[model samples]
Target: MIITGEDIGKKFGKTWIFRNQNFEIQSGEITSITGKNGSGKSTLLQIIAGYLTPSQGTIYANGDQIDEQKHHSVFIGPYTEVIEEFTLKEFLNFHQQFKKPVCSIEEMANSASLPLDKMIGDFSTGMKQRTKLITAFFFENDAIFMDEPTSNLDDEGFQWWKDLLKKIDQRLVIIASNDQEEIKCCSKQLNL
Candidate 1:
């Protein structure tokens, strides 16, 4: 898969967040977007993932125009919220209703070290990040977008993430982060 953004830009009201950005991201590679705070790294990632629309220009996936509703990308970010009221099992079941999981429920639960009956609201910050990462990684998708993926992770959790990243194949991975270790995983980068 190839994602091409042409002269992309985004604005909130009259304030432009980013402008005149262009790039082509292909499959089987990890790409990072880096910038100081509020430099639009997350915005660009959101636009590429089809979660946010660009105020100007267009994006294409494998030569076809990208449609947010129909796009088959998995995005995990701090701003992306899960149903805190649901148990892990309930949330997994709910998610499976829309998209079939690549792993079994038991496997996912084990991999994330999550109790099946535990409520998401009760999970620690690290646990939640683990849950989100597992959910995104366990799905078969064309693209994966991660914004500040290691925000709440501890040393062990950080290593776990690095190990997990090695297992990714073929899919296009786009990460928006400032972590040096995380940025090193990417073969290419887009600096905002």
Candidate 2:
């Protein structure tokens, strides 16, 4: 899969978060979107993920215009919403109804060191982040977009994140982060 953004820009009211941004991201590579705070890194990522529309220009996935509903892409971020009301097992089961995971629920839980019976609401911040990462990584998707992926991770969790990236290295992975360690695996950089 190849995703291309042509002269992409976003504006809120009178101020432009970013303008005239362009990029070509393809499968089997990791790309980093880097910039300081309030520099629109996350905004650009959202636009690519089809969660937000750019004020100008267009984004094409494999030559066709992007459509969130039809696209098989997963977005993982510190703030990415998960069902806190459901237990880990329940949540995974629910997710399977829509998209199948690359592994079993037990395997995912074990890999993340999360308890299947525990409610997501009760998990610590690091654990929650693990949950998000495992869910996104193990899912069958063409693209994975992450924002501040290591926000709440500890040393071990951080290593787990890196290892998981290797396992899914063939997929199109784009991350929006300022942390050098987080973006180290990226081969290409899009400086916003």
Each model's TM-score, in the order given?
0.93, 0.97
Q: Judged by TM-score, which candidate is best?
A: 2
Candidate 1 residue lDDT tens string, 1-192: 999999999999999988999999999999999999999999999889887889999999988778733656789987778888999889988888877688898898887778999999999998889888877788777789999998888888788888888888998999999989999999999998
Q: Model 2 over residues 20-77: C-alpha lDDT tens digits?
A: 9988999998999999899999999999999999999999998888873366778989
lDDT of 1 at 71: 52
How far does residue 74 in candidate 2 sit from its true spot (Å)? Answer: 0.8
Write down the TM-score for model 1: 0.93
lDDT of 1: 0.88
**In candidate 1, which residue pairs clash?**
none
**Predicted model with the maximum lDDT:** 2
